[model samples]
Every structure is written in C-alpha cells, then in structure tokens.
Target: MAIIKCPECNHEISDKAPVCPCCGAPIADHVVTCPECGKVYFSNQTECPQCHHLTGKEVAAQADVHTKPTNVHKNNRIIIMVVVAVALVVCGICYAFYHNAQSDKEQIAYEAAMASQDADVLQNYLAMYPNAPEEHVDSIQSHLEMLKAIDRDWTNAMVSGSKSAIERYLAEHPNSPFKSTAQHMIDSIDWSVASAAGNVESLEAYIESHPDGDYVEEANDAIKNLNTTTVQPEDKLLVAGVFNSFFQSLNARDEEALTSTTSPLMTKFLGKSNATRSDVVTFMHKIYKNGVSTMKWQPMDDYKISKKDIGSQKIEYTVVFSAKQTVTHDDGSTEDLQYRVNAKVSPEGLISEFNMVKILE
Candidate 1:
C-alpha cells in the first residue's frame, strides 16, 4: 500500500511493484537511496550515484579497529619471549660465576695444603676433595709414605740405643730430614760407648772412625790418661816375623820347628791333654793328617803391639794382626778364611802365645 516516485517519468507508483508503471523500468531488490541527493542506486555500488561519496569507508574503519588488536597481541608475545630469553641468560651467568668461584676456592685449599707439607693436611685434603688431580694425589700419597717410613726408622734407631743402629739408619736414609739429628745421636752414643770401655784402644778406635767427632778432645784426653807405653817399630817387626815363622812351621808340618818356636808354657798347655811332648807332636801330626794339603797367609795392615810385664827381665809383646788364610784340603776343596792372629812374643823373638780367631765370612 506504500507509494514511491519513479525516477524516469516522475510518476507515482506502488512501492512493492517489480517495475515502475509510468516508465516501464525494472525495480532492483538491492537498491539503496543516497541521502545527499535522494537518488536511488544498487547497494553493491562503490559510490553514491548522486554525490559520488565512497560507500566502504565504515567497513575500512571497522577493519582498522580489528587489525590493531591482533598486531598488539603479536607484539606482546614477542616482548614476553624476549623477557624470558634475557632471564635465562642472566641465570646462566650467575650459575657460571658461582661454579667458577667454588672451583677457585677448592684450588686454593689444595694449594694451601700442599704448601704446608704436612701429611695430615694432605690427608684431609684428599678426604675433602676426592676428585683432585690424579698426579697430585699420587705425589701426596708417596710423600706421606716416605715420611711415615722415616718416622718408623727414627723411632727404631732411638729405641735400639746403639751407635751401630743409628749409623745404619743414616747410611740407609742419607737424605732424610732427620739426618743432622741422627748424626748428633751417633756422636753422643759413640762417645758414651768409648767412655764406658775406658781403654786406650777403644778411644783410639773411636778417634780413628770419627776424626772430626764432637768428642775428639775428650777422647784424646782419655787416651793420654790410660796409655803411656809405646812399642818400638823394630819390636813390632820382630813380633810380626815370629808370628809368620810360627804359621810357616805349621804349614810345613815341622813339629820340631813348631815346638822350638812355641813358648814352654804354650807347649806345656798343649800337652795338658797328653802326657809328653811326643804326645803333643802326635796330636799335631793327627791334625795335619786329616785333610791338610797346603796353607797360605796374607797379613793385613792393622798391626798393634801392647807391652805387658810378666815378672821377668824379658818384655812380653802382645801382637794382633788381621790376616786371610787359604787352605787347600786333600779332597781338592779350597777354603778362604778371614781371621785375626794374636801372638805373645818373648824378648828372644820366640812365640810365647798363639791364637787364631775368625773375624768375618
């Protein structure tokens, strides 16, 4: 029932009609009216037909409003990722700093322990840092063992209370830290031992062994006090020759020569087991018959003579010498013997006493 004006004929027509009746023009279902000019046009048109105004301006404004929020969201996501990355970097830096500080502390402690050069300190370090450097750990362990062994040896030497033991320890561990202490102990012990013996021979031996010893003056004083007697060089040679002649007679199995060189007391003492000198000669002959083939004696340079008075005008000289003997037995077996020969020589250059003692292997 509504009425509309037709554009071509300017005539009145029904609004619901499919065409305008006056001009016979078709009506469009998607028509719009331009407000500015009161003109009718298709709704899909870009501009108003009467005024040429753009129709999609509102849609563009709406699109701008929607797109702005999406861009802001994307920017916010990027900011959040950047913040997270920065936080991670800071945390890593802090961890690395802490780790390096801890490692430095450990290294300082290890070096301090090593500088101390104390076994207990090194042991504590090993216990604290089980992952220490391998070569360093091994060195610490080896040094500790050496210290322990040295301590043990030192204790044993002190306990033994012998000059020989301390000397042996010093000989074995010459580079030990306690070398000076051990040497001092040896000097003290040697002086004590020589003083206890209270003899010129012991003191002289001590002086010979320790020329620059701490007790050299004391030893010389002791020697001057104990001994005032001296043997002439010619008497020493005479006694030495008598000993040589006695042994030569024994090697030659000359019983008459042996009896002539031997003192009357020594011959009597030898025959104590028998009744007569013939029985003594028979005893010697039996000894020589067992396995004796040949005997040789080489004298050493350590000859000493002591003059002793035995209630006579004659002087008895006690002579001692170190000698080596090589004995060839009848069974083709040879024996090398190290022994000391002690003989008492009378004023007539005869052997008054004779004894042989084994010295060493």
Candidate 2:
C-alpha cells in the first residue's frame, strides 16, 4: 500500500483506503505524487500532506478558480448590505425634509389667509389644508360664518328700503362691515323725506338731528325759501289776539277767565303735573296769586304768525312775539322784563297751547 495525501487537510493516508483517516476525503484508486515536492497522494487528492501543496494538475487548477470566485461573492454581499443601509438612511432623511417643508407651506398659507380678513380667502385656505392646526381651523370657520351672516343681513336691509328697518339693522349689527353704507342710506332717506315735505320745520329738524348731514346745504336753501314767504295781516292779528287773551287772563289770576281763553283740550294738556283742567287752572292760579300786584304788556316789533292744517277742516295757528312785560310785585318791587311768547291758536279762536320764556338781556 502506498501513502497518499488527504484532499481536504493534506494529511498522509493509505492510497488503498476508500476514505482518508484525518479529513474523511474519499481516495481514488490511482496513485500520484507531488511534482514539486515528490509527495505521494491519490489521483483524487487535490493537495500533498508532506509538502502541504496541491498535487493533482486538474485539482490545483480547479481550486484556484473556485476559491477566488467564492471570496468575491462574499465581498460583493457585504458591499450590497452597506449600500442598502445607506440608501435606507438617505430615503429617511428625504422623507423627513419633504414632510417638514409641506407643514411649513401649509402654515404660511394659513397665516396669509388670516391677514386678508376675507371670507373667501379663508375658505380656500381650509380647502387646501384640511389638517391645519385645530385652533386655527375653528377660528377661521367662525369668522367666515360671521362675515357671511353680516353680508346676508346687510343685503336684506338694503332690499327693505325702509328707514326704520335700516336703523334696526344698524342697531342689531353695530360692528357690521357695511356700517358706513347703512349710515349713508339712513341719511339719504331722511334727506329725501325732508325735501319732499318742503317745510322749514322738517328741514330744520333734519339739520338738528344730522349736523354734518350730506344734504346740509340743501336743507339750508329750503329754509331760506320758506322764510322769504309772506304772511297776511288778518292771520297775524288773529294769532296775536289769542296770545294777548292768554297773558291777560294769567295776570288777572282768575282761573275761570284763564280756562275760558283756552280750548278744553288745551286746558287739560297744559301743566304736565296737572291731571285735569281744574288742576291746571288751580296750578296756574297758585303761581300768579303771590306774584304780581300789577302787570302791563307792550307788544314789540318782532312778531311771526304761521298756520298749519291739523286735520280736514281744522287749522292751527302759531304766534311768536317779542314783548315787554312790566310787573309790579306785591312787595313793591317792579321788574321790566323782555319776554318771548309762542302760542298756538285753535280754529275756534281759542288758545290751544301757550309757552312763555324770558328773553335774556
């Protein structure tokens, strides 16, 4: 039996043995020797035990080719793993950057919409970013609803075209966006009504209520026109007599005479504290009882008489007079007074209302 080297471990073994004792490599029947070292081995043996070198010519060539390829495959696997890890890391960074950029974009759009204070802009922003911050979403929705409601109310008010309706809307929605427009409409309506009336009192009342009114110039012009109109002498005398009778009755301290000079309605309506005509007479009598011992009236040059229709077949006349009233008190104190008297006369030649105020010196 000749000695042989194991193919796997290069251990010496019998060539006749089917398997090597040290490496369990199956031995071929043919014997061989290492050409370089002269070590004996089987034909199937790829290496010599004595020299620790490959022995078979075909075996050495095959080993050389297979070993290099296996090593290359392992190195390639490691490189592939590293590349996969790096790619995963790069993908993660890109995803994070994209997510953050999208969030920032949404935030910026929301802020811009809020700044506009427009309902449409805010609605568009909500449509673009449904996942916007909770607080901002709720606030935008509320503001949009409010603006829509105001628009609805304002449009309804304009359609109504009534002064009271517009005024009611303004009172209800003090902070409405159309506040200025509503105010202008109210002024315009007032001006139109006052112009159509074509009366000095109505125009003067408008001017008083709206000092900075849009039709202030027109109102002044209307007043000037009315003032230029003339009054008849018979009408002036009739108005004057009503006032003279009222003052004379008041000075006389006779409740019966004073009450007789006034219409029953006028007697009842005089003196806010008096509930009945008798109460009004008693109240006036009390004022005059202790006051003047003697009173004299002299009419002045400035006097006005105007008539207005109260109802069908009923006319009311207003008399304005500047008069000198000299009063001698019971204590012997005499006062020379300048007085202004405004009196309203009924159609039946009775005084309907009397207002007396002392004119300042």
Candidate 3:
C-alpha cells in the first residue's frame, strides 16, 4: 500500500483505503490527481459508461455544491449570534431599569426614616433592607444602631431616678428623640429638691435656674409664705434687738443715735403719719431739751409681737411693749412715768415707727 493525500482535507492516507480518515472523503481504487480538473478522483474511470458523466467536470461541480452549503451554514450561525447578542442587551437593560426603580423607592423610605423622630420608623426601614447591597445600606445600619443606643441610655436614666443621670443623658444625647421629656424631668427634679428643702435660698435658686418652670407660681407662693411667717424664733430675736437699741437711744435722749435705730423713711413716729427719722430725732430732743435732767426711758420685759404689713421692701412687725421712765427735774423734783408703747420693726433690725398706745400711770 502507498501513502496518498486525502481528496477533501489533503491528509496523507493509505491508497488502498476506502475513505480518508481525517475528512472522511470517499476514495476509490487508484485514486489520484485528475490532471484535466486539478482535483482528486479515481484514475481508472475517464467517464461513467452508463451515465457518461465526465470525471473532471463532475468532481468540479461537486466541489461547488459542497462549498455552497458551507457558506449557507456560516450565514445561519452569524444570524443566530446576532439574535443572541440582542437578547442579552435587552435583558441587561431590563435588569438596570428594575434596579434603578428599586433604588428610588429605597431612597424615599430612607428620607422618611431620617425625618421622623419615632424609633419604629427607623426599625421598619432596617427590617426591609437589612444587609442589602444598596449604597445607603451602611447609613441605615448606622442610624439604627444610634437609635438603639439612645433608647438604651434613656431607659437606664429613667430607671435610676437620679437627677444627675437625667442630666448626663441630656448631655450625651442632645439631639435624642426623648430630649424634651428628659429636660422636663430634670426640671421637675430640681423643683422637688428645692421644695423639700423648704427654704427661701433653695427655692430662689430653683427659680433662677428655671424661670419658666412648671412650679414657678408655687415657688413664688412658698417664698411669700416664708417671708411673711411671723412666729419665727429667729425673726423674734431680730425684732427684740431693734427694740433694745431704740430704748437705749431714747433713755440717753441722743438724737443722732436714736435716728440711727430707725429706717430712713419712717411712715409713723410718736403718733404721726408720713413721718421721718428726723422727726423721731426732734421728738426725742424736745422731751429732754429742758426741765428734765438725767431723764431715762426703759423697756419692760412684757412684749407682744405681731405681723405688720410689708412696706418699704422689708418685713415689718408690730411690737407692743410696757415701758417705764424716770425724770429728774432741774428743780430737784423726781417723777416716774409708765406707758404701754407700740412700735414697728423691720427685718433689717431697724425700727420704722413707734407710738405710746396707753398711759399706765
């Protein structure tokens, strides 16, 4: 057997073989190149005796038919490729549209969540897009965490029932959802503390801190009560001191020192209205200026004190006292005087007014 080239693929093969192995082209005995047609064919046949078809022209015609089918198949493959490419482009466009629309909806929801003060709005938004691949996913998760932390801190603050705790909550979360309520609670705590103390300074401090607090009216009332209460032991001691100074100045018949023990603007003195401290000085001067040498006026232990009306921006008390006097006349005659005297003393330990209500002797 001799090696020969395949007719269709030009692969070397056995000449005695019935077909070429590479191209599977049919081979006949003595297959060789046809000189007239420049193609591979059986050399033993010039033409078919029965059909009388010439080998050179017939093989050439067969080659034309074979190449024609190959061209047709290539065109079909190109058309199928174009159709598939168009389908993929359309699918990509549809997917992009769907994702864009979903993104728009998520944006709207996110804005609403941000605007709302309610924690539930944020929670619902988180529930819908948890662990999503959207751009604002991290932002939503961060907001949810912040809200949770605020809620946790607020609950702790409320449970503790401490003013400092509430204050700390306000300091930490200034923009918290419970900000207003938290501040109000702190204000109430201050008022409660001040009220429990029951003092003017403490209540005044509360007023200074919260001018528009819920208890402002009540605070003012409490202050008024404290200022006006007449039976206070401390207040009584102050009034007694003022009475002593006034009597000491009177017994000496010293005009300036007597005026020093009285208010600058006295409303009454020696049974006169719209009186002045100068009026008291002049009255004391006239009592001892002549015919009375070494005159002495003394206050007795019997004292009655009551609340007088507030005047000249001071708390005034009406004090009634039994008084005694001794006058050594220039003529060497001695005289004894007894009087039930009434006076008004201010909280600043100063006398504002005085009168002899009754002559006891």
**Tens-place lDDT digits, model 3, residues 1-361:** 7776775577888877876677655564435565554455544455543344576766555555555544664687688889999999999999999999987888888888877767788788889867555656676667777888999999999999999999999999999989989878988999999999998989999999999988989999998887775457777677777777787888876677788889888768787887888788778877885777787777887888887446654666888888888889999998888988888887666787788854854
C-alpha lDDT score of every prediction, in listed order: 0.71, 0.74, 0.78
TM-score for each of the candidates: 0.35, 0.38, 0.49
lDDT by residue (287-324, candidate 1, tens digit) is 55568798776677688889865555457778778887
Tell me which of candidates 1 and 2 scores higher on TM-score. 2
When 1 and 3 are scored with TM-score, the better candidate is 3
lDDT of 2 by residue, 1-361 (tens): 7776665578877777866666454554444667878866544447766776865567766556555544664687688889999999999999999999998998888788867647889989899889888988987888788888888888888999999989988998897768888888989999998989888878999999889989999899878656544355676776677667666776776678777777776632433422345655865656555667887766675778776766664667777788887879989998898877776777898876666678998
Error of 1 at 82 (Å): 4.0
- State, as a TM-score between 0 and 1, how close model 3 is to the true structure: 0.49
Question: If candidate 2 were superposed on the true structure by all CA atoms, what would the RMSD be?
Answer: 18.5
Please list all clashing residue pairs in model 1, or write none if there are none: none
In model 1, which runs have C-alpha deviations exceeding 4 angstroms?
A: 1-63, 66-80, 111-117, 171-177, 193-361
How many steric clashes between backbone atoms does each model show?
0, 0, 0
